[model samples]
Target: MDTLLSIFDVKLAIENLPFVLSGLPMTIAVAFLSMGVGALLGLFLALGRGSSYRLLRWPTRIYISFMRGTPILVFLYVLYLGLPEVGIELTAFQAAVIGFGLNSAAYIAEINRASLNSIDTGQWEAATTLGIPYWRTLGGIILPQAARIAIPPLTNVFLDLTKATSLAAVITVPEMFQKAQIVSGRSFDSLTMYITVALIYWPLCIVISAFQERLEKRFSRYVNE
Candidate 1:
């Protein structure tokens, strides 16, 4: 009982709470920065894949294929280590953001493509019959509707990216997991520190999930119609 109690170390966890939390800002920066950049890239990729031009479609396909096939860690390592060898240096934070952004963009592209395709073909025809410009029709009619469908899935991907930010620890970005590792290493209370990290992540994930649920409910009427 005493050994288990010592391992848990509630007092130490409480004492180091702020230290562990200090990395929250960096973690959030990485997650949201990736999501923001990824959304834009993903939108372009989706459009490229859907385009009639072989020049656009083929290149986008290859890019998505390569990104999806490669592991994010490998991408991170390539950016952080391989690039430096070629004189393209990147800070750990920059490397993490780029890696996460590229990875997230591939998944986001697929999700956006699926959502865009789920929109009816007749809508495009109707807009054409009305003599609407293609870009205007897409912007005013198609994308808004697709966005409603895409939000839930995109939010899920955002959450996944947030969790994956833990991988940044490998490059020493000093994110939440890395902070926990440092605290654990110093205190020799790995169980307690690790559990504290879980506790922090759990609440954050729950809050994001709740926001997604609310967004889904708000769009339910449009989907039902």
Candidate 2:
């Protein structure tokens, strides 16, 4: 009970919240951008991995393997530091978006590939019989179905990305975690400030989880029925 913080302390944590909330817009922008970039690149990577051509397949396989196998923090450093040597200068926040998005793509690609594989072989044959191009068949026939199968894993990846945003503090993106650190360092109320940030994340996670459930139900209803 002694460690329990007071209402004044918690209120102090939020009173000057506008500055912290300003950083929130950047956090949201990074997340949505990450999801968009991640999903598109992941879709192609998944397709390439599933391709019949050795040239197309092997490289993507290696790329996905490397990304998935490595830690994202390591990836972040390489992109932020190593890329600068090659004339790529991303601001810290930009680098975070790119790194987290790329990391997410690797996992999402695997999820998509697995979902695509789960479809009956006959669906491909049927699409071919209808004179649909292979790519069209994939887009119109397969991907929507694959999307349903991919939802749970995709949701999990988004959650991971959301949490992983804390790492932005390392490169100084001034996100929630970084804000907490700044506040704690100033007030010496380390526990109280971090507790507020922790509180913020929990509700966001729950909302995303709830949406994921609704998406799962909507998709399942179509296929299962």
Model 2: ten consecutive residues of lowest lDDT: 1-10
- Per-residue accuracy of model 1 over 25-88 as CA lDDT, tens digit each: 9999999999988999999999998889999999999999999999999899999999989999
Clashes of each: 0, 0
Off by over 4 Å in 1: 1-7
Q: What does candidate 2's lDDT look like per residue over 27-87, in tens digits? A: 7777778888899999999989999999989999999999989998888888777799999
In candidate 1, how many Å is residue 170 off?
0.9
Residue 47, candidate 2: alpha-carbon lDDT = 89
Show pairs that collide, candidate 1.
Answer: none
TM-scores vs. true structure, each candidate: 0.93, 0.92
TM-score of 1: 0.93
